[model samples]
Target: MGHLWVIPAGPPLGSALVEKSEVVIRNFFLPFLFIRIGLLTDIFSIKDWKAFVSLGMILVAAYLGKVWGSLLSLIWFKTSTRNDLLFGCFLNIKGIIELLVFLRWIIYKPIDVQTFSTLVLFNLVLTAIVTPLISIFYKPRKRLDRISKIDNCIRTLQSTLPNSELRILCCIHHEDNVNGIINLLRASNPTEMNPICAYAVHLIDLVGRALPVIVPYNTQKRRLVANSTDRIMRAMTRYSKGSGAAVKVQPFKMISPYNTMHQSICKLVEDNLIPLVLLPFHENGEFQSRTACVQNFNKNVLSYAPCTVGIFVDRGLTYYHPSNICYNVAVFFLGGPDDREAMALVSRISSHPGMSITIFRIDLLENSVESENDRCLDDAVTKEFMVGNVGNTRVECHEMVANDSKQLMDAIKKEKDFELVIVDFAEGHMMSLLVIQSVESIKQGAKLLPP
Candidate 1:
């Protein structure tokens, strides 16, 4: 009667209720109830007054469905209002059901792939990003810190990055009262802790008066997020101290899974330039697992970036697992000013000892002239892309020209699923082209890659 979906997922809450509550999305298990009860039969199919009632019911359901799901999550999961809103938005944003609808409509198979994907991506992106944003951006009065100059501090600390030229650098807190923090840095920098390199730093804390209340930190019993954090820190410290740090397990206070860690790392970045953050991963099935910061950073801040980030999933500081995680990387090139900048980014992390890289010319096209002058420019284009090597990752220039950027994106999309998509998106020019594809992909519900 409220015309809303609760969770929008999982098994039956009973057919009688589901039949009336299925709304418009048919892929979910409840849609069968809508059909069996004939709620959508003559009303929707015949487009009669019955259909009018059904449509009204569906609209109501979507709204209530989202609300119920959010409220339930907040209560059952002990999620903060911010997390509950995010969870509700994620649930109700609606998509697995979208595919079944498209399948039903696939009789009209002459669909535009990019255009269709764009609509879907745009809808989902707005819902996913914006729905929770309302909750995240507006916060209670208690959490605001007076020190709002973290960005300036970030700049000052950035200049102090150790081995600014090295492929991999570890910034540690060799003498912090926060044992967990110290242990983590210690494990990650197992080589030799350069006492001068590690220092204090901070990021724009998630707790802004303007932002929503944080996910409750003290709810540590329900497989708390910080448990994994401790494991990661210990691993890094052990690696840094070379089995010598002998740090025993000690429980730390509750930590914010995503935002707090981001701020901590940002603070660290102010003093140390560790491009990669090695986070501990517990197999507890969380999307924001070890790479939460990576995803968060890519989504919220990388474009405004001063740097690129690598998120580490710890596998203990064993002799076999050393400091090596992902030494292999891939870079995309479009042969533009941004492509040149992307190459410069490669310089920061390429110095690692065993990193191997594959560079792709997703698309490069120059007018072929009958005269030699055209050929001269083509050669220059090739030379412009020649960004030597960084550390162990030998930059291999893989060249292939496409009819256009969509085709290039298509080609790259079909290739291997990469950990990251590095694009040379220097404003204007082809950057506009990528923006279109990005929008289309986003509309179709794909996450955005760092530009």
Candidate 2:
């Protein structure tokens, strides 16, 4: 009955149900089973000298058989000697299946009491030592330590080389998120000279399964049970076809617990050398019920991600079809790394024929102190953007000065007419203040993109 639930035609089960079942089994049934087995086994049977010798022989034979058997099986595949040995060590661990078999054999008189005691002791001893043996034998490589400081700093739009493919990991939570994300992708200005490689990952909560899985869209034999994933895939496919080699998308479905979802995402980013990851804001109406889970996932991603992370708040961009309407984008730039990244992304968006970008460079008041290094970098990035888009009527730049959070809020309120507002969550500056205040002050029709 438990196995049948995994069938495609079976009734759907929620993650909560599986979680409750696991808790019950682990807390109640497993302990009872172990206690019953302990009561049935006789430790005195293995104390005799002859019994001790027989038990030692059985342990040696079982260890050799289990380890060598696994090693011999791996000869058909291409694997290193160390990995094969590690695999064998991992296979040495025995579990409830063996215990249940021992109980049945003892009840049916297939094995005597001495033999049963020897087998149970062998199982316990092997299981206990395998972990320490594995730890001693297998040492994993640290991928993060191998990454250079330059690589860490360059994983954003401002640092990407010219004519290079811009790789992005787009995380989709629901069908409603598809339209806003697709619009953003379209506004990225993919061209023959510079293409976009997008990895679309649909995150599903782990449910009704014993292990997590990441399934590729093209490899699945059956359609995904969730229609939301299918709809997102279809939308991405249509966009890919229409882009005519300017864009390529690889779709994946990652089913994992919320607590560990960010690890999978970060691993994907590291493996693919993705520069940017786009995430939906957790405060969206669709996510309100699971706000805490979604927020935790986003926070974990931000903390562990090796690249830049963008939190997108979709207001009404879903209604703005990229093919028909021109997108009015406003960028609020303050001097910092995050603001520079926002500017770099806006530079790309400004190149799209359907995009009109307004750059608002906000400066701190004379009374406020600024970091010289950060100010220099910000100026360099802004200068490069201006030089790149010289004489482009679609792009406009404005400069503003604000003394405090109130003035910054007023400045943002004046620009509420734009369809999209881009800001950076720059710490220890007016930018962060603006982000906190603008959440409520921004017009209802404007989308917000904060990195």
Candidate 3:
């Protein structure tokens, strides 16, 4: 009856209430109940040879029963052997409810004290070993690492085929992220010739649930919808419809623990052959407690992602647009594979009618030495971009030489106000530091100046 009511009544109880209830039950009730049960059970009662033989039989019978049942059920689904075995191990973990049933059977004289003790010991042993067993059999991180090596060869915009569909995985954290993501998608300028396939995943932290689930919006059966998720889905639908055949949106809700979420994401990317992933920047306000977890999640995604991972720092791209004005965008090219990827995306965004782009090719004067092969690759990409955008008034390219960090800062400041700025994630570069400082200064100047 409780399970039947959950479909219709679960959301009304509120996630907060459900989470608190789970915490109380897990941390307080279960431990206390287990202690009480331990006090009632006698380990010495099962010392006889007959009791020892019965205990051994029970352990074998229980484990084999669960494993055989799991294998039979999973064979029809064609799941992996490891998964089948893991599921069987999981089923062997008997919780408090099962212990209560055993106690009741003992009270009713249906099961002897030795049998009850053996069953309890069986449960304890299974529960203790299941986690380690699963860890040994199923290594998600290792699987992802293998996938990363295979995907690195082709999972990038620069390597994408010409006039082919662009697949992007967009991760949304909340309603605040919806508008920024939609705006970014629009700015990509999807068209009939170069269509986009967007997978918008709404990420929800796992709470009050034992297993994580990924639900597709169209296949969901629940009548009550989460407001934030509903809004995100509706916005994605609207964008898909408005873009006609240019954009195809597939929305999904992923409820998972942050610790293992990256594995799921990387798997999706590998399966779909997606070339890019867009993650929202972890904000430092309101949800401060979640910031660290989100930051860690982002780091893991970057580390394990099978494709290019972009952290979008949205600075009012959706709210600051004015009518009949071209959106100004600036791209800083520091000359690397990451920067080349940024340029590839910039080429796409520059196609938007309302966008005007300025490409700043910055070269350091002090440590200007680059490998001959690397310089040729950079020149090839830049030359291709310049040749393609030749005679296009909306696109402008500037070659600048910076002698030091201060000169880099001054060079960036000379550019006009831009609504969006794109930079590569090249570590250990002084240019990255200067760009960050310049962006902050720009934000301060914007606040100080009137609209």
Instruction: Judging by TM-score against the true structure, name the best candidate.
Output: 3
Give the TM-score comparing model 2 with the true structure, all chains together: 0.74
Cα lDDT tens digits for candidate 2, 1-451: 2555444411135555665687888899999999988987897876576867876897788778867876775668866777787887777665789999999999899988878887888788877888887888776423433342334545667668768899988898888778788777777788878899889998887876657777688633567464767778888888888888889999998888787788788788887888888887777765677777787887666656777788777664635554665767788776677787788777777778877888889986742566898889889989999999998999898999998867887777766577677777525221121121233435432323223
Which residues of candidate 2, in runs, are more than 4 Å off?
1-28, 42-46, 60-89, 112-141, 148-155, 162-164, 191-194, 208-212, 219-226, 243-246, 257-260, 283-293, 363-371, 400-418, 426-451
- Give the clashing residue pairs of candidate 2, or none: none
The regions of model 3 sitting more than 4 angstroms off are: 1-16, 64-88, 95-97, 107-109, 150-152, 219-226, 318-325, 364-371, 400-415, 426-438, 441-451
Q: Which parts of model 1 are misplaced by more than 4 Å?
A: 1-227, 243-268, 271-298, 303-328, 335-342, 345-355, 364-395, 413-445, 449-451
lDDT of each: 0.39, 0.73, 0.75
TM-score, one value per model? 0.35, 0.74, 0.81
Better of 1 and 2 by TM-score: 2
Sort the candidates on TM-score, descending order: 3, 2, 1
Q: Which ten residues in a row have the lowest lDDT in candidate 1?
A: 430-439
Candidate 2, residue 93: Cα displacement in angstroms equals: 2.6
lDDT of 3 by residue, 151-209 (tens): 34378888787588999899998888888787777777788888999999999887656
Which scores greater on lDDT, model 1 or model 2?
A: 2
